[model samples]
Target chain A: MSEIIRLTTPLKDEDIVKLKVGDNVLISGVIYTARDAAHKRMIEALEKGEPLPFDVKGQIIYYVGPSPARPGRSIGAAGPTTSYRMNPYAPKLIALGLKGMIGKGKMSDEVKEYCQKYKAIYFGAVGGAGALLAERIKSAEVIAYEDLGPEAVRKLVVEDFPAIVVYDTHGGDLEEMGKLQYRE
Target chain B: MRVVDVSEITEAVAKLCIDANYNLPEDVYEALKRALDEEKSPVGKSVLKMIIENADLAREGVAPICQDCGLGVVFIEIGQDVHLVGGSLKEAIFEGVRRGYREGYLRKSTCHPFTRANVGDNTPPVIHYDIVPGDKIRIVVAPKGGGSENMSMVTMLKPADGLQGVIETVVKRVDEAGGNPCPPIIVGVGVGGTFERSAFLAKKALLRHVGKPNPDMELAKIEKIMLERINKLGIGPMGWGGTVTALAVHFEMEPVHIASLPVAININCHAARHKEIVI
Candidate 1:
């Protein structure tokens, strides 16, 4: 195992370019959350020339719809959702200078291509390890699309939020590489 | 004859909903524990470790095992000698689901399929009922997440296609699923039934204990073979690749028409959550 890279939100191109597939990352600072419904609305807003819920530049979007938080909790059993559903909207956001995404599962070839062209990265977290992952998130607040319920866009303050770079700007794909290494 | 109050059914459903989501079943937990040792990839091993840890944390009841608390799927086996009183059986199960999500802090995942409006309170559970020869009712609550449910399929094959075709179809389904359904999955295969019955059988197969074979010797052999073939796909934990893509392959079957050999594959993610109660 190599050293774990530490990063904060509003990530820079230079910061992303240095990363590669299979690199472990500890992301600290603010990350935004959005899933199926929120993504649809965001795409619609952009088509109509309205501003996004937040500035997309340099930020990472986590694909998740977390369970409700109980009393005295910042968030509830939070973890990554499958990322492929966001494929339809991710390329546009990547073009708008979004630097990274954190989720589980494979991305479409088009999404990977945009990541390469835009110098962004795709990270994968343990998909069902929600309770364990929740401990790393210090706070969460809904910033947009509250009508969407769990799919509402949330602005989260996280610390050492762990993930692995599955797709890097250099055309490295960990999902492809890792499978080949173990496929018997 | 024994009388069962609808209120009792409602309360039991509510508790089972919370229990299923907040706790990982022992069979699934044990499967993951074994996979950790057998997984070849470092990343796969670590992912398995974290999943195990998450189950441990979820048991404390602060949160569910996963964020997608899933659409409540309840199975009921009512005894023939029992009389249900006080209310509608369907309404009782739905009420249980609502109360469970509300009181347990689980995510309400049901919604309008086309309009995409949130149901707000995870109600109208998908209920399956069976009549048995007893005085008790067996209730099982299995909260199935969207990720894995999307990966499920029902296929109809020629009678000539036989067992080999079924095995190939199941293996292909898992291979195509890649990592999307959450690897280290449990595959439930239903064969030898009509289209809808096959689908139901596949889903019901998932309620069985992980890694346990069918009591029928022939079906057990097929399950063991399919499990080996699926794990060889190397989708690993969460699909990043490893030696253990699936923990088990559970098979269930029923008699079919002479011309049809319908098969259904229902995939369950690593966070397989189901609980049962007898009352």
Candidate 2:
């Protein structure tokens, strides 16, 4: 059985430890958005030992590149992007004390191993539910790579953001577990 | 010759692009609902619930279905009797695409393939036009996102390889794809057509309503079988593993040369944003 938990932004290492595969979570507070371009920059920054644009410690990074907001709207359609593209960079971030990742799709083996070793959790939001998800984002501001267009990194404040645990700190994966039940 | 004004076509194309991007078609909505009910994994079911809810919210003008609005793919079936007037047909279509992306507030995702430079306004839509025996023009607009588009595959198999080879290849492609294309996906399989035609047919197959069978009984059966086998792979909604990896398997096939058995697989995310208009 899986438990439903509410996670706030700047997620703690302990909080991530408590999560397991198949857990349903309603995340609130702050989450940072980054996609392929941002991920590349983040990793590059780490490699250069330069100051990162944002503090990743005890933070959750969401893989997304939202649509442009209409007037008066803080953010536009905000759905999770595929996570596999971030696989190469994820372990390094995990080594940096990153506590959580929010996206859709399967993680690479290295990513899964890092999550287990570093006590982090991988959560999946509904992939196409951008409009609904955007509704939960109370505010958003570009933090880096403005020229990358939608792929820019944005600091987001959200409330009741829905997600489910696809990978957990203990090496349990909802994807693996679910497959076992249905496999012929 | 019937004269068709280029301006009229441009306006219609623009509207179709915006409409297709913003609205989730009725048939697609129903298909997701049915998938949710039939999905066996609790986790998968929950994901489907979110997808359905997202669609409802999009309909209510709450949000766009997905963040990636995708490249504008326009398929035009021109009436053979019609003669284009006023301006270049291709230019008119491109103008429509530009206006639509801007007005719709949709993302501009097009870029140079190798250099990876943005194309500014998402112009130069991938227009596939065909002249047919008709008095009316039929346009089908499908905005294909990169995630699923990236997962698409084309292969040339030996003639003796048979259906088993086709099945194995598709399964491998999806398996390698894992959650990248955003399961529960809709798999569009194009078999037997020439290399390029197979790819075209694969994309066209995605325009069909989920779970709807082909008129050809043989092809329809193949669709069902493939659907079952894919689900059995245990890649559920969003690739989290479950009994509903694919909501539907659509196959489009045509006769090909004896030497070739070309197969193309195109995957559509849960969003499956597409719409049609006739003028």
Q: Which stretches of model 2 miss by more than 4 angstroms? A: none
For model 1, residues A99-133, the per-residue Cα lDDT tens digits are 98899888899999999999999999998888888
Top candidate when judged by DockQ against the true structure: 1
- Output the TM-score of candidate 2: 0.97
Tens-digit lDDT string for candidate 2 (A65-127) = 898887779988999898988998989888988888999878898999999998888998888
Off by over 4 Å in 1: none
Per-prediction share of native contacts kept? 0.75, 0.78
* CA lDDT, candidate 1, residue A98: 91
lDDT of 1: 0.92
Error of 2 at A29 (Å): 1.5
Quote the lDDT for A62 in model 1: 95
